[model samples]
Target chain A: MLGKFIAGKFLQYLIVIFLMLTLNFLLPRLMPGNPLVFLAGEDVGFMSSAEKEAILDKYGLNDSIIEQYGAYIKDIFTGDFGYSYQQKRPISELLMERLPWTMLLTGLGLVLSTIIGVMFGAISAWRRGTKTDANLLTVFMFLSAMPSFWVGMILVSIFSAQLGWLPVFGAESAWSNYSGIDRIIDIGKHLILPLATLILISVTSTFMIMRYSMLNVLGEDYIMMAKAKGVKEKVIKYKHAMRNALLPVATVFMLSLGFTLGGATVIETVFAYPGVGRLMFESVLSRDYPLIQATFLIITFSVVIANFLADLIYPLLDPKVGSRNG
Target chain B: MNTVLSVENLSTYFKTDKGIAKAVENVSFSLNKGEMLGLIGESGCGKTTVAQSILRLIEYPGKVVSGRVLLNGRDLIKASDKDLASMRWKEISVIPQSAMNALNPIFTIGDQIMESILIHENVSKREALKRTKTLLELVGIDGERWRSYPHEFSGGMKQRVAIAMALACNPKLVISDESTTGLDVLTQAQVIALIKNLQKKMDLSVILISHDLPMVTAICDKIAIMYAGNIVEWAPTEDILKNARHPYSQALLNASPDLGNPEKEVVSIPGSVPNLVNFPNSCRFHTRCPLAFDKCRQENPEFKEVRNGHYTACFLEGVGNHG
Candidate 1:
């Protein structure tokens, strides 16, 4: 039964990816524009008609829509994302360079925020109706309402422009030729503001959900039984109650992890970080069709895969799900 | 006989916007070692409250306003938090209502039982696991089933698991608070039988809290009938069954169906349990009592002994009338 369920889920995700790929190929082409113009940029006016034809031909833009789509599918399968018109480089190479920065920024932010948020949430729920709970609720409510970029800007104005404690933008010091740990430290310093912005903005949802979930679990008879059994207060709260409460939050964590992989565009833009989010933002503005398509496809696939994992892990977290499916 | 638990003038009240709801007021009962005392009551008569008060498990909006729960001579109400913690599973434990929700869904049955043993005893994990398997077997479940989660079991199995968990630390007293509530009739009977068997074999004192009068009459050594947070009558099983003094107790016996005497009418009590908020200091059952007189309304009757091991709180029983 478990094997069958996994197989079914895998099939569903595969369909989702196939549909996303088709849409990715079609959506960019459906936009009313000439890729040759985007490719030429300022050189568009100076380029002869013959040169323009050569450029279009090189990109296979002169082929029929169906023929181009077939090649697009084949190219994706072979790990080739074609070329970026705006950057004058391969789309795959551009993504490769930007993906790690996005991963570092969002990966660290997600891990830290989830740990801090889930812990605070559990504590807040445990101390429900108390001053600490009320205060946390108020702060998270404000954070949930505020935009990430606005938070980034405020943080920049305070920490960068005012105190000058951290860098205002970019992923590293531009002029530094520093190597070894110094270079690492320089990069680390630059990562702080955007990373902080991501954490503050993202943490509210997790905290709120966890608090709500924990409050529900606290009322379960098992928790009362645990208390009656003389289980330590900490063990009851963290192990018995929080373990069950974490079911819903696990899904939230997995979803955010997938979304974060695409990068926090607003945060990346605010910090001028050379991450995938920033790359996608620039691609959209310049209508770099290949880059935009490649980024969106990767993001969509990542989300589908993450959702699949959540489905697989849910039965482990909640045995009831497994029985029901079986 | 040595008393295992003695509850004296125990009162638990819930603070509400309307007023203080006297859930369990001036309740008193004593259970001898290895005795099964059935705390039988209507739905709102505060049976669970009395149990929680005894365990000192009452939380916010609810307080054990006035009580003395002496378990083996130690006053639990005044016991320090650490003292209480040490006593909880080791000295006394509860088999909660809805065994369905009483076992943590995420944890294995063995792990949950082992947790209780490991926390209170200076045993290694291996020793705890070994003890957990034995407890499961004692409760009529396969020792190997300890690895299963609550959801992996049937309702009866989950209840059995709950029973095993209750016995994890070999508690001197176990309170089964409607632990058989949601099970089918056969499952309920099986669970209760298991408890009775374990009680006898282990010499464990148990408070079987339920509204199932017939079941209580069958297994309990003594019975306390509650009416609107007051213990209207308390006596040995035979005395309560054959010579009930309180109006509520007699009414309860009349209401229950008799299998042997199939021709006998099953009559339900006339009125619903009274609301307890700011309840007047009079007979709580006066409105429902068929024999209620003006004197019954003028003052509350005291729970006084009329026969050896039999007590009742009713003016009709020739008890003193303060008014």
Candidate 2:
């Protein structure tokens, strides 16, 4: 039964990947204007029409739309994502270079926020009508309502500008000739503002979902049964109630991971962090079709895969889904 | 017959927006060791509230306003959180109304059983697992399904798992609240029979709460008929069936389907119970009582013994004088 479920989920992921890849090919090509002009900058006006045609033809942008699509799909299997117009480099190479920074920022942000959120959420739900629940819920509500990028900026204004506590720009220092742990520590210092901002924003969204879900789970009959069965408050809250409540939170967490990518776009721009989101932002403005398409494809793929992972992980937590009845 | 549970004038109320909703009021009963006592009532008659209040498991907006729930000589109603924590599942445990909802869905049957065993007893994981397997066996579920989750089990099997969890700590009193309602008829019989067999084998005292009269009578030696938060009558199962004197008990008996005599028309009591927020100051059952008189409409009858161990709270009989 579980095997069938896994197989079905895998097929669903494959279908999504196919549709998204097709969209990646067709979407940016539909936009007008050539990216070669932006890459050429001021020299574009001086160049003859024949020169423009040559540049377009060289990148295979002059090919028929169907041929381009076929090449796009074929190139994907070959691990090629075309070439960046501005960088004059492989789009795959460009993204791979920037991917690690974005991953470190988002991954650290997501993990820390999830832990903090689940703990606070469960506590708030347990306390329900108390002052602690009220205070934390109110603060998180305000934090959630504030735009995350703006929150990032506020942190920058306070910590970087006023307090002079942390750096405001880039993934790491170019000036410092340090290597190894010293360089890693420099990167960590630069990471604080962006990571903290993401953590604050993500925690609000996550805690609210968890708190509501925990409250509902706490009301379920089994919770009361646990109480009647002499289960300790700690055991009942964490093991029984939190276990059931975590299911909904897991789906939300996966979805939030997707949004954190989108948030990184705004955050990277604010911090000037060298990440794929920043690359995507810059490429979109320059209308770098290959780079834009590749970045978009990666974002879409991450989201779809995250949800697919949720589907796979959910049945492990809930045996009802592992059975044929599910 | 030594009294195992002695509840005196137990009253539980809910603080709703409207007013204090008396869910259970002036309800008193006693259970002897190794005896099954059924508290039978229709839905919303405060039977479940009585069960929750017994364990101090009443959630917010609900409170045990007044009462004494004595188990083995200690009053649980007055016990501290620390005392109650130790008392629960060790001294007294409850089998909830719906077996399907009572067991946590995420937990395996073995884990759920082991949880209670581990909680009230100082035992290792291996020992708890052994006990869980034994408890599952006691409930007639195959020991192999111990690691199976609650959702993996069928409704009957879930009920058995609940029974196993209830028995894990070997509590003195087991409160079974509508424990058979959610199952098929066959499973209901099996569960009741299981409870009966377990009760005898373990020397247990049970408060079997259900609306099904025949099902309750099958196992319960003593029975209490409740109406609108009041225990209208208390008697032996056979006495309540053969010589019930209160109007509500009579109506309750008539309403229940006669298994042997299918031709007899099942009589359903008229009018739902009044809104509990502002329950009638007089007899709570007078509105639905077929033989309600001026006295019943003006004054509530106090529960009193009319015959040896047979009690009723009705002014219709020449007993329970309101003045």
Candidate 3:
């Protein structure tokens, strides 16, 4: 029974992946403007028609739409995502260089937000109806409503320009003379503003969500049972209430991970950091078709994979879910 | 008889936005060692509130106004959180309603029981597991089922696991609050029987809270009927059925559907329980009581012992006593 259920869930993900890839292929073609024109630019008017046809033929754009799509799909299976016309480099190599930076910032942001948000949420729920809960809730509400870019700009203005405590833009080390510990210190200093901005804006939402979910779980009869059993209040909150509350948050966090990656495009550009979002922004300006397609494909695939993992994890986190399958 | 738990004039109220809601008003009772006391009432009659107050589990907005809960001569009303934590599970425990959802779904029954043991006692994991195995066996469940998750167990088995978890620390008193309310009839009988048998073997005092009068009468030595936050009548099980002094208790007994008396119509009370918020200043039950007279509306009746070991709070009963 368990094996069949597992296999059924795996089949569901396979179907989802197929649908996502089909959409990825179709949506870009449906959008107005030809990729060849966008990539070759208006300056190409000076060139001869034969020269343009040679360029198009070279890039496989001369083929029929169906034939081109079929070949593109075939290439995808072979680990080939084509070459960037603007960068004169493989799309995979560009993505490889930038993927680590995006992961480093967003991964750190997610971990920090979850820890601080859950801690605050649990404390606020435990002290419900108190002044502390009220004050903390008010602050989170304000922070959640505030736009991320505005918060980032303000933080840079105060901490970077005014205080002169950190560098304003770029992620490079400030002290060119220094190596080892000093270089690490400079990079850490540069990261403080962007990381803090991302974490501060995102943490409030997680805190509010976790607080609401925890409060609801705390009202369940199991919490009362724990209390009646004379379990410590801390145990009742953390072990029972918080653990149950984390189920919804885990799914939400997984969904948020995808959005966080896509949403950080503006934040990355603002900081001038060499991340996937920053690369995408630059690619759009230069009309790099291969780079754009590759970036979008990578992001779309990650999201689909993340959601699949979330679905698979639900049965493990909650036994009741698995029972339903049986 | 050795009295194990005594509640003296316990009054708990909630200060809501509307008004002061009197949840449990001047309720009093005592339980002797190895005795089962049944607390019966309709919804919103403050039966569960009384149990929660004893555990000091009432959170903000609900406060114990004036109460003395003496467990083996130690007053739980004024006890610190630390003191309550120490006494809980070790001396007094509770098997809450919704037994199926009470156990952590992620954990096995063995881990959940071991957690309780580890919390109050400093024991190794192997020792706790051994104790948990014995406890599972004691509750009529196979010890091999210890590794099973809560969702894997049936409703009756889940209740049994909850009972086993409650008895993990060998508490002197165990409170089961509507533990079998939502189970099937056969499951309910099995659970009640298991509790009765366990009570006898362990010599443990129990406070059984339920809406079913017949169920309570089956397992309880003493019974208390609460109406609008007040204990209107309390007496031994046999005396309550035979000579119930309070009109409410008489109404409740009359309302109980008896299988043997199929020819007779069931008698339900005329009105529902009074709202705690903005309740009339007069006797709370007067508005619902069929035998209430002018005197009942003029003043509230005090809980007074009218017969040997039987207490009732009603103007009609008071007048009968005086007459």
Candidate 4:
């Protein structure tokens, strides 16, 4: 039974990877203009008409869409994504440099926000209609409604400019030649604003969803039974009510984590942070198709993996979701 | 008979946005030790509310405004929250209405049972677990199935788990609020029989609340017929079934199917229950009572003792041959 479940989940992820790769190939082509023009530089108006055809031929754009698709698939299997049209460097190298920063920021943001959100949500539901719940709900509603970049800008103004507590921009100072721990600290210091923005944005929605779901769970018969059985109030909340409440909220949290990934691009761009979100934003503006494709593929795969983990953990959270164990 | 559980003038009200719901009012009854008393009432009649109020488990907006739930001479209504918590499951346990869904699905039946034991008793985990196995076997479930989740069990088995949990602490009383509801007939009979056996063995006083009149007649020693939050008839099971004094209780007796009463016409109570927000100043059952008179609408009937140990509430209590 376990084997069958594992096989099915693995198969679903395989299908997701296939579709994401296909979309990666198709989405960039739909963008107007061409990366070849960017490669031709600022003197494109004076270039000969024949020179344009030569550039297109060199990049394999001269081939039909079907032939290009086949070549794209073959290139993927052979670990070759070609060079970036605008950067004059390999697309893979650019992604490797930028991807890690985004991963760290997003991963940290998700962990912090989820912990904060779920705890507050549980407390809010446990004390429904209280002043604390009302205040938290109102604040979250406002935070979620505001865009991540705007929130990032506001945070930057208050903390960096007015308070002078943390750095406002970039992963690190350009003039600093610090090494090892010092450099890590510099980057960590810079990570606070954008990180806080994304965390606030992600936590607000998760808190609302968790709070609502927890209220419903608290109304279940088992919860009442727990109280009647003389179980401690805290035990009833965390063990029984929270255990069931988290099933729905966990799904929302995972989905929102993916959603937060998308928003990170705007916040990263705002802070001038070198991450996949920033890279993707700049690549889109410059029409750097290969870099954009790599970022899209990574983001899509991360979402798929997150959902797959959720599917695996669901049986642990709610015993009624019978898989192999039941 | 020593009085085990006594509820006097109990009134529980729910303060909702729309209005104040008088869920239970002037509800009074007492259970003798080792006696199985059935509380028979239809849905929305505040039977479950009465049970919850006794435990003081009623949540927000619902308050036990005025009541005295004397369990072995201690009024739980006046008790502190700390005292109530301590009293629960040590002296009184509850088998919830939706028994199948009462146990936590994530935990094994054994763990859920052991939780109550470990809480109210000074027992180690291993000791509690051993007791859990014994409790499970006592409820007719296999001791080996202790590690099984609630979903793995049939409806009857799940109810057995709840029963095992309720009995884990060995309280003096168990308020089983429709533990056999929504089960197949055979399963219901099995659950009922199990309860009977456990009561005798444990010397338990039980308040068996259900809408199943026939089942109550078969198992309970005394029966209390609740109508719109008031006990309309209180008598020994045989007497209530043979000749109930109240109109509503008479209607309930007629609703039951018996092979001997082939010509007896089954009559459902006419008119739905009145909104409990402002329960009547007169008889709560007067709206649906066929024998409702001018006096019945003018004044609420007191619970008068018509005979020894057979009490009823109706304006025509001693007037005529009503029941």
Best by DockQ: 4
Worst 10 residues of 2 chain A by lDDT: A254-263
DockQ, prediction 3: 0.62
Q: What is the C-alpha lDDT of each candidate?
A: 0.91, 0.87, 0.85, 0.85
Give per-residue CA lDDT, model 3, range A136-176, as digits (tens): 99988898888888988998999888988888887666447
How many angstroms is residue A10 displaced in model 3 relative to the true structure, after the best TM-score fit? Answer: 4.6
Better model by lDDT, 1 or 4? 1
Worst lDDT 10-window in candidate 1 chain A: A33-42
lDDT of 3 by residue, B1-323 (tens): 99999999999999999999989989999999999999999988998899999888887789999979999999998988888888888888888876987887777889889888988898999999999999999999999889999989989999999999999999999999889967999999999999999999999999999999988987799999999899999999999988899988988999998776788678988877777896666788888887888878888898999889899988777555432
Candidate 3: where is the Cα deviation over 4 Å?
Answer: A1-11, A44-52, A173-179, A258-263, A284-287, A308-326, B121-124, B318-323
lDDT of 4 by residue, A1-326 (tens): 87788788889899888988998999989978867668787878788889988888888888998999898878777777777887888877887787678778887888899888889988899889899989888888888898887888899999999999999898888899999999999988998888888888878877987899899988889999888887888899888888788877777777756644443788888999888888778788888877677767767877888788777777777776754443
Can you give the TM-score per candidate against the true fold?
0.92, 0.92, 0.93, 0.95
- Model 3 residue B138 distance off true place after TM-score fit, in angstroms: 2.3
Q: Which parts of model 4 have CA positions greater than 4 angstroms off?
A: A256-263, A322-326
Best first by lDDT, ranked: 1, 2, 4, 3
Query: Where does candidate 2 clash, by residue pair?
Result: none
> A1-326 in candidate 2: lDDT tens per residue?
66777788889899989999988888887789767777678898899989989877888879998898899999988989988887789898888889889999988889899989988998899999999999999989888888878998999999999999999899998778879999999999999999988888778867988899999998988999888876778888878888889887787788867645543888889899988888999898889888898889888888987888778777787777666434
Best-to-worst ranking by TM-score: 4, 3, 2, 1
> DockQ for all models, in order?
0.73, 0.74, 0.62, 0.76
What TM-score would chain B receive for each of the candidates shown?
0.97, 0.96, 0.96, 0.96
What candidate 2 gets wrong by more than 4 Å, as runs, is A1-12, A32-49, A258-263, A304-308, A323-326, B122-127, B293-298, B319-323
